[model samples]
Target: MKILQSKYTNSFFVLLTVTGLLSSCYKPKKHFLQASGNYVLALRTQGTNSTTDYLLSMDTINTASKNISATGNGIEQLAWCYFGSTGSTVFSFSYGTNNVGIGYGVREGGGLYEKGRFSFERMDCFGKGDDNTLVAIGAPWGGGSYDCQIQLIDATTMSIKKKKLTPLYMRDGSDKLNKWPTSIVVNDNKMYVSFYPLDGGSWNTDLTDTAYVTIYSYPAMDSLTTIKDTRTGPIGYYGNQVNMIKSENGDIYTLSPSSLAAGYTQVTRKSGILRIKNGQQSFDPSYFFDVETASGGAKVLSATYAGNGLLVARLQIPGSDDISKLWAAFDVTIPICKIAIIDLNNKTVTDVTDIPVHGGQYGAQGLVEDGKVYLSVTSTIAGEARIYAIDPLTATATKAAKIEGLEVPAIYKIVN
Candidate 1:
């Protein structure tokens, strides 16, 4: 296997132009995949930029964070989703560039740090799922004035072979797929995608909001097929954020960044967990976790199933405001990242520990085995990013590793 390396820089313009030049005009034929690998985590790395030229590292961990290749622009977002088969570990994601548009890649690992390769052209990959085959949603950049299509790509080759699905928005006043696509996850053979339609629409001053999710099924991996059956979400909440994990018992738990109560609706605040059963279309109202926003309201930094009935969730609490410094032009909000152990059987949560972290501090990306939580945080006095491990029972954290090189470091983990 060849070791892939990337160079990090503030510029990606040259890389973008080169990526476009490498793509072939001839389209590849589709194949019916029999099986895939078991991917335990979706390790991702991104530069702390809030704009279009956001860069991403190809290898999640084990390898140093390097910028995506052959592009002059940069990566916007990097995410991973399982495709091909039930136990198959095959996964894919995309990085951004100016002329390169979007660059995508696939890997074959079940651990935190494993090697992978760069594959195809700049397809605006929105989200994906598996039915023995990889079914993805996105459209070509210059395809049309208004064009939305879902294509099925080869799991091994990472090439587009079939155009299977597309959005059929609300017609004659009916509802449709949300325009702002955020995240996608799958349970059983069903695909759950979260999207909000504020992309091309004008920003509204109204407080009332609408977020939507669609549940659909595609053909089996052996069939070079398409999905015609689709269902839209029922009348409910409005927002385009999603963080989901599938439990050992086949239950789907999705986290949202909205309040379930009134008055706190428009704060861009609060934390919530929405539960949905496997192969279901709507969320189970009874299984929801709503954290407060005032008086050090809790925020879910990250969450993952620790197997069995145990779900580990992370929370952060900001310190109280300074009344004496009200006259000052700017203020600092010190944050404390905490971990929680949730007893899913009883639908209850217990505070583990605050994990001793500060603002812009390193935080845990996801949960790990053995009830241990990993976090990357800055030493406020030391001014450096360090990795830490927290024990859930004692609610105490210990320094695990110190990330080198950055004045302020960004660290993420992947496990085999």
Candidate 2:
């Protein structure tokens, strides 16, 4: 770790003196502290929204710094294909065409087709496929439920294949797909598919809303032999980013966020931790986590078991609100992000620290590989989302690197 500078020391000392003299002291936080790392910080000029794709070469960090090997240029999404214990390789996919517009002005939320919004186009799977794999899923805006088809792409060619997979509900036993697919995850040799309903149309009004998880055996994205019950938890909680982890003793846990009602005051949304333990196919009915918020509820952005009944989670504070609400109550302070150290053995959740939100709207989206937490700060003021390396053990942040030119930084994981 780098030592605090003498100039900072003097400046802080003066501030501390003023704080002590004032009726209410304002203390400075160590938000911009520097720490040392052996890894390279690479920049790419040809990515999804930004101009670059980045693949960190941990094995070759000693030889190159800021040197990223590009997978697919001029694209928004990328994923590493991990062939289940056979090792891993890079496979990236960019929609051949632009379809949706920005969510707001020139089309708001950005273009759907241009930004990989049609399905899990925002998500990439990292698994070996025997010539057939569900590479992307989602609905192209202004399309029907059938518009939500799953693209079985050719891993080698990085091209969308002719064969596509759709849920039983979406198809007529023929090869039709749905329009409201949400998220996808692979577990225990079975593929879990979650689907939702589309909004703003005639069929959208007739849409009988439901979510499904279709499980299929490996090597075949075909034939949904078993339908897993995903309704064990609360209703109306849209699930995303399902992950599976196994303990050394052989117990399995599935972790994801279960979003609840919105905040009464702020634009914050509430979510709680959802855990399915002991190889169970469904969520435990009584296993709701305790996350209290008037506006934004408890949300688990990223979670991983740390063994011996401990789990580390990257949590975001409630700041996501409607623009009108923000304008009405304009003096709202930005909530500081935090990391919760959950001890399942003791059944307790401990607040680690105020993880530091520099500027406005910055939140943590990724996990740190070396037990540290990685946070992505979307500073409209900075015009980029800066990634920070948080030492969970010390509750200190080390300014790591920045991801520039993104509308917002989504989930990312450390590969090294």
Could you say which candidate leads in TM-score?
1
Write one digit per residue (lDDT tens) for candidate 2, span 333-415.
23333456655444455655544433222111244365665544444433444555555454455555545433122233222
- Per-residue lDDT value at 212 in model 1: 48
Q: How close is candidate 1 to the true structure, as a TM-score?
A: 0.54
- TM-scores, all candidates, are 0.54, 0.52
TM-score, structure 2 vs. true:
0.52
**Over 4 Å off, model 2:** 1-87, 96-135, 138-141, 151-162, 168-179, 200-212, 222-270, 290-296, 301-316, 319-354, 358-368, 380-384, 391-396, 402-416
Clashes of each: 30, 37
Per-model C-alpha RMSD: 11.4, 15.5
Predicted candidate 1 versus true structure: per-residue lDDT over 264-303, tens digit per residue: 1133324555667766666665565554332146544345
Alpha carbon deviation, residue 238, candidate 2 (Å)? 9.4
lDDT measured at residue 376 in model 2 versus the true structure, 0 to 100? 48
lDDT of each: 0.37, 0.35
Could you tell me the lDDT of residue 374 within candidate 1?
A: 53
